[model samples]
Target chain A: MASALRVLGVDPGLTRCGVGVIDVAPNRAASLVHVGVVRSSPDLPIERRLKAIAEGIRAVLDEHRPHVVAVERVFAQNNRHSVMGTAQASGIALLLAAEHGVPAHTHTPSEVKAAISGYGSADKRQVQTMVARVLRLDALPQPADAADALALALCHAWRSGGTATGGGAVTSLTPAQRAWADAEKLARR
Target chain B: MASALRVLGVDPGLTRCGVGVIDVAPNRAASLVHVGVVRSSPDLPIERRLKAIAEGIRAVLDEHRPHVVAVERVFAQNNRHSVMGTAQASGIALLLAAEHGVPAHTHTPSEVKAAISGYGSADKRQVQTMVARVLRLDALPQPADAADALALALCHAWRSGGTATGGGAVTSLTPAQRAWADAEKLARR
Candidate 1:
């Protein structure tokens, strides 16, 4: 059996950022490693709130040392205010992943739901139940955001068909993946 | 006359981020220091593009050592795709400011236009012309984003009523300014 791949998934937000870590075996079984939320007060200034979020994420990276980082993709929506905050938080997640040399990917909400529950339009309750069952958790993870994060990690692991060995061993690469790798190399230059 | 305060303004974007630096005198006279755009190819992956932008901004910070950093505040608008990218870039600007210990501020587009042109609803040409005239430049800055960036820096300097020496020196503090300062302190803690 290929070694388990550790994935860190982030559900980015300004007030409460959800983070979950999981180890996925090659056979597609997933086990929970860590799950929590990073909270920042809305009373704070924008930059200060962002700083706290970045620091919180950095601390998580230091503690868990996940092989890969997965973030939820922000889409255009009617709630501009909410979307802007989500995008900002998502940027911090991607930046931290790059700073730590971890490969980062983004999965849409629907993609995550489909991957975990086999239904793109699965409701929140359905996703939560499925995530719990997949990870063998005795009960659903509190906070819908935490369950969403775990789903993101699982989606990326299954889609990529690769194990993230903290040491940076990628098992397979498609042309697009090769392009991403080349682009990352150029960015570091 | 007190020493001039150097300010770096950013009009954040994913594909083309506008950056401008200026030195504002105690008497409110402004002179341009640097103005340019950081371009990242759309063909690159999002993380790679973000990494390029962060590196580009870091290089600017290293070279300029500006007293403060100013970013154009993003507003909710139609076109969710564009807004998301702007917010992401804005987040990077704030994070970089904190990482380098430089105070960061945000100014709205109307605020910038009013400060530079005395008209909140000024047209693009009006803003470009006013920015050139204020800096005593012989010609208008190319690429409207660059000129907008210069306007953002000038707006913050005029509104803040103080220099950003990182020493908390200010002529006066409004309730909002005080709140921002307190939040920044808490973030640094």
Candidate 2:
């Protein structure tokens, strides 16, 4: 039985976190599964926002049952206040993944674009277009952030030999396949 | 035999994530347990940074085995770029707590200050002074971020009655006691 892999991609944020899920199988194309956003406000205390992020994300993970999580890696911010705040929100995403024993894969902005658009410097619209094309969707996903997240998940689905089932693989790769698998896993942006 | 509770407080960042752990008893105050920082740079891709943050935080969690994890909540920022970047880092901290089965808590800047100091609007110096006083330490914890994280943990320790070990007696409280508890737990600022 060929395994199918479901992936969830997260674009972390304090007020608006974009998320998407995708599924794929070995030697097969990727499929867009699900996508949405988790929105928190600045007026809300950090604790409340965290609760929202955590609960909302956990709901997504449980609903999708993705085998892998794709997270956009942290980029540097010039403003200290903004950087710290963003990092805190990202922490919530990581926590959600860890809770379910799903290992998170990270990808750079450039890497996601390069994998999707054949250019590292591709713009958001171009990447979105490619994501739609790859997923065989007629229309692009709403909310650019959601589209970006879906793109990240699709990137992972395309790169990693996906599971045939919509969820994730239950088996572990051998040491020989571990490094390549880790690289495949971690490289999903 | 009474079991001591170990709490880990984290200040999440893409460049440097500060971690501090403390041990506390029911009536006795907190003691410095362990402190660490995970550093990453923009020069490296976000994949590497996420891996570093994941590995470093896991090591800390494994080594310290804290019962609770407290992280400073994300604050508002005007800069869009910085906000996005830091949000990602905070996600890492959240992931660490969930992955390890450690209950996670979050504290706002003012909540932390009010817990450390008598007032919510207290300055850093005042908060640090109170932290030193409350913890009975010779000096304020170095690096404002680390101290802030430690203060956040203390704040959680205070409101949560320390380590979540002893359940608060559901005593009928005087209006004044109820007011104080409400203010302590629900105060916005």
Candidate 3:
């Protein structure tokens, strides 16, 4: 709460990792601090690809110093291949957050779509249009993945944070869920 | 030794994993190359992504790199994501040869696909045709994931590097999946 919050939304991709950071200043507008994609071709070796993704994101996190990270949650789209790859990339994004001690939250595709486009079933084009409008970008973002990831971050800002989030982070959790998680942790032993 | 060895193939993706590998050489090629997929998606949370995928593949033995560790038998696919967010990273790749001082292998997707396809199935479009032509690829190269993984490495010359496997100096088996693993070991003793 003391520190200014910056939200970085990532549309995780195995081949193309899209990262966008928005700086939210108190009583002011959210500025687009960073946006880009970590591009890796499917033709390269897996090891090299992973390093690039990790390093690329690490740079964004370190450079932007975002308070929390918001990522596009992985939704099962029946396309097994797409789902699996997205999950892996998402995992890496979480790892980046965890490693950095930054809390990372995942938003479902529908939820993300709804927040940005006001329609869960909104196609990629529609989501992009709204993201551009919300961010007040002069032109539509390039590489749909990048724009989508940025939009996810923007959605997080709308729902939470200083002016948003309704109440402090304490009320952020339901007592029941918190108790269940504590019990689950004890059970792991 | 005359019989072809077991090989496991791996196809890494966001959700629909395609694994198939078989042992095949100039002559000896047999047995099943384990194949299946783990699904993960944008719908799932970051933690679930790890849970769903089992976070990619791991093996029981250095059985893959049948030859030397210097050259990996199977080249990792160049899915840009694999490089940045690999399930295991260098520590995991060290598996085949790292512990025992043996070597791990690396292979490109095309090489592995070619081993199954007379020609390389370099693109996704070619995968179906190549998958259809699998007569010569499986000597003991197990699943498509295993086979593909090994094909990349074995393509380099299983004949010369026949000693690339157990004979290497690397302590191959990981503690996570070591030959002596048991419940007691995991009990924090």
Measured by TM-score, the strongest candidate is 1
lDDT of 3 at A189: 32
lDDT of 3 at A23: 63
Predictions' DockQ, in order: 0.50, 0.19, 0.08
lDDT score, residue B93, model 1? Answer: 90
By TM-score, the candidates rank as 1, 2, 3
Tens digits of lDDT, candidate 2, B1-189: 146667888877767777888776655356777766777777754545655676787898899888888877665543545454455566666656766766777777777766666557889987777666656667887877677767776777765666443234345763224324543433232
Q: Sort the candidates on lDDT, descending order.
A: 1, 2, 3
Recovered share of real interface contacts in candidate 1: 0.65
lDDT of 3 by residue, A42-85 (tens): 86444455556767888998988887888876544334454545
Residues A1-189, candidate 1: write the lDDT tens digits: 248888999999989898999988765567889998887899876777888899988998999998999999987664656777788899999989988888899988887876666667879998787778777788999787888888788777776664552232355664234323432333343
Write candidate 1's Cα lDDT for B1-189 as tens digits: 248888999999998899999888766677889998887889876777888889988888999888899998886674646777788989999888888888898888877766666657879898787677777788899888888888788777766654783343464764234433432333343
CA-lDDT, candidates in order? 0.79, 0.67, 0.52
Q: Model 3, B75-175: lDDT tens per residue?
A: 22334444322432222333323333444445555554443333454554344333333333323333344334434333433332223342322345432
Q: Worst ten-residue run, lDDT, model 2 chain B?
A: B174-183
Q: Give each candidate's interface RMSD in Å.
A: 1.4, 5.9, 8.2
Tens-digit per-residue lDDT, A67-164, candidate 2: 87887766554354455545556666665676677776667777677667766788999888777766777788889889988877766554444632
Model 2 ranges with Cα > 4 A deviation: A1-189, B78-81, B165-189
In angstroms, give how far residue B113 of model 3 lies from its true place: 20
